[model samples]
Target chain A: MKLRFRDSMNWLHTWSCVVLGCLLFAVFLTGTLAYFQYEITHWMQPEVEQIQHKDKAINQAQAYLNTHTENAPRWTIVPPNERFSPIVAYWRDKNTTGRFSVARLDEQGNEINSRATRGGEFLYRFHFDLHYMPVFYARWLVGIAAMLMLVGIITGIVVHKKIFKDFFTLQFNKGAKSWLNSHTVCSVLALPFHIMITYTGIVTLMLMYFSWAMNMGDGDRRSFFSAFSDQAPALKASGEKAQLLPLGDIYNSAKAQLGHAGIGSIIVSNPGDSNAMVEVYENATEELTSDYRTLRYHGVTGELLHDSGVTNAAEQTRRTMISLHAGRFADTSLRWLYFLSGIMGTAMVGTGLLLWSNKRKQKMNPRFRIGYKIMDVTNLASIIGLPLAISGYFAANRLLPLQLESRAEWEIHCFFIVWLMAFVYPILRGCKHSWQELSFITGVSYLALPVISIFTTSRHILNYQFERDATLLFMDLLLFFTGGLFIYIAYIVWRKGYEPAVIARPKRPPRGVVQ
Target chain B: MTIKAFLQAISNAKGMQILWRVVLASVLGFIFLSVFIAGVASLGSALFHLSKATLMLWLMLIGIVLYCCLVMWIFASNKLMRCSVIIIAGIVISSAALYAGDMLHKNHQPVESR
Candidate 1:
């Protein structure tokens, strides 16, 4: 039978989301939290105090490395920025474990024993590179999820009627209609953000999904990546040894040459060799594009060798798209905006999934099939499970032994284990009562995290000064607000009566349309 | 149910049609997209004088939109046979053009080893 485009779109949107909505919700929520990744890391590793002078920190870092790993051929320093997290240093040496060493340094450039946790970096990577899975499969899964989101947004727009009027209309406690209204309001409020985010997110790693595109390419892959680095075939280690110049001097010269204060990272190839080359990478946080403006310098002589920055319009567009998706260039205020829009995206997907299940249940009235039970359980775990898992991750950070072997990996294990329990609990209790209990448990766990940290760490919530320890304070307050919000949800579910006591089935559509 | 009855169930058409759409949209859709990228890159090289680096810069970035557009079109239209035929034909033609281009490159750079 022939159907209107919008009718087909409605069907497409429903089935597509029904299949991929859980993945979309997890990605949206985790990715939204990743906006404050740096701040979260700072909170997680409070031992690394804020630096007064970044240049001095760089110089002191170089000095520490010079004295400590004198024989190491290579060194790379990821300098701390406005976030005030500990700087990371990597060096290559034959005697080291895994042929390399990585150390966290405080503001004074001394090695510090920060609690071992992947912190927000894990959450950020988890958004795209899921856990307990190979990177290849994880990326493909995320890529499909992004594609689903993009299609869902498009089809939703097509099927929506009276869009402007619907945005202003939200009828509370009206069963499926309420669900529909919440979903519509959330989608309409952040419509542009949803489109831009999904499109740009897919572009960031589309090739992974379309791996066959690699077969169609004719040129060396390095050429495509050459835009990031302009160094003419890195200077190999020479037999003859020479004294290397102070890295502080090179940093100064590079700053003078580039006239930019935002130095992101510094890489030194073949240290103490005559052919030593130092590459200073520009942070370029002030720019629209996330292009890596590299300045290669002669390590011994401190002479400028190469600088690669300019690109064609197409390349510029590509860089800008990626930068926009990552939002690394955004200041704190704009980052919060991205974060809030992401929350709305998560809410929109949640309500849409609920509406789908609610509508399906209404249609099959009084005959609750096992299929419908499984559907309810799936929704319960996906919507409530993930936040429960996230809270578990934070709790593990404070509760786990500081010196536990591979402490970081175990924190993640705790997260997944709790997530598994989230599913099991709902199934055991049944969906009807599970929503309130699970959310309440999740709420209590989140609230308990800041309290846990108070005794575990040197600092507490109120002890942290706003100006000096803003990240620490923000993290505590965020946990409190999130906990309170979840508790409020539990109350709402309890009051409204979970599992919608009665929902009127939508009427049959006109002839020639499949509704 | 017997095999005949099961076959009849499928031939009732709704279930089988969706399964066909899934296959067309995923496996064949990927092949179509790959061919589409190769075809676009080949045509761009022949026309624009852009380096492979610059060409790929645009190809991979914009290829996402093209892929989404193809998926939407595949699902929106009910004509499955036409979609499959167009996809297979596009692949064959694009492969032939790429093969021809490789031969031409070999002729020009006979002394340069692959």
Candidate 2:
């Protein structure tokens, strides 16, 4: 009975992983990349150089807003941080609808005429809000996949009873065993991270998945959010205009109140009116919880209005889970740890998918069956083709004309078009040939990124100015490393072929009869 | 086991039954577990005087692990009929408890003038 139960769990783990493995791979890869999203964005927009004086960023942002958006009712200033250098500011007029108009400023408060691109934000958003579909549908699909993944992980642990014993058992060149070993090693190495990331990812979208629970309560969604966050109510704007106090004074007061915590954003509501308020949000990097301690002041009188008190235990616990998932509080070293673990998670999925095909391939007839063929094509596209598409996205950023209209949208379109082409290529050509070719293409594209940057932009790795910008240099080196890894794999596939030599093993009596 | 023997084993009638059992466990079984969890959590929220949001958050946080355990349980059970019966009974009982709790809370509320 125990043996039968173990077999059942093994079956559950394999099928669940194979079914949703592609989407999980995409999510894991993009999420891993999102750890460095801001750095990648900075690297993409080369016109905005990193500057030294970050303390005066608020004053510079205020000055820019005062000059350009004098009549605007609301202003938001995002100061320069370690990952991003540009002081990004945005404003909305009293009657405007939709998003606020944004401006990027250098240290001296000069507006940069940077090329229009979504930059790393496309990759970041694509991790959850997948492209070419409505966000609502994408999230639901991702949520289902995430739930299946949780099931797969739990069942996988149960099936592998000798999990600790086989922790370091990664045999190579042994066909199905090799693939299984790789899968096990990757999954086991980052098991804790996998569990935490998957569970917290679901929690991050808890409201959507469990909205029925919220509806059962007395309050609506907004009221629930306000209760969860303990946010102060917003004061309505008065028509009577008043001379606004200097933002520097408000910033100073906020800094004094915050003490050791850093300021993240400065928000000014009703900027020129009597009821105008300035809200300063603290960066909760040193703490586990993402509850940003806020201080609000009357813009006209410069008198402090509200100070966000300590969060209760329940809210603090919830926020901490969110923070753990987002890793916003992580420093550079810790962020890299998160990134490496995420990569392991992606590799675990990739290996699991490959194992399914390999296991079935050994048992199936020499001629391709429909099931085996479908698995082959999907495995090739998802494991190899998706990375190729991401490389194409970076290439498009450099290749596309700078003055092109809707350039950001074009970049995203280029990504999907490349991905679709990859998805189709294996169906036309055989899986082995297509995998080899797509991998080669991916390698060459990534390798050529730095060269293309050298020709097109002043922020290339070879340029003298890039010597001072560690972020750009690090990104180039990482790209080069990835390019080399892909090329090596391509070469190996070409030389040794896709499938390993099937080893002969002695047959044993079939396990306990099926229930 | 040899490839041919293994393939034949899976293609047999008994193997087909196990396959369907797994399919049931993954789909219908998962949904039933989720509904059962929601009902129980709602009942707990009403009984304990906990804020619905906080209790719901705790439930959602642990819901995935519980669902996985349910799937494992469905597969591990010796008799499929017995497992299904228990799951159905759980759903019915929890739903009734939740409905009763809702009604009691409504009756206790002060009626407002329209």
Best TM-score goes to which candidate? 1
In candidate 2, list every pair of residues with a backbone clash: none
| Local accuracy of candidate 1 as per-residue lDDT tens digits, A403-460 | 8999999999999999999989977888889999999999999899889888888877
Fill in the DockQ of model 1: 0.44
**Residue A471, model 2: Cα distance from true site in angstroms:** 1.0
TM-score of chain A of each: 0.91, 0.90
- iRMS per model, in Å, is 2.5, 3.7
The TM-score of chain B in candidate 1 is 0.75
**Candidate with the greatest lDDT versus the true structure:** 1
**lDDT minimum window of 10 residues, candidate 1 chain A:** A221-230
| RMSD (Cα, Å) of model 1 | 5.4
Model 2 Cα shift for residue A236 (angstroms): 2.2
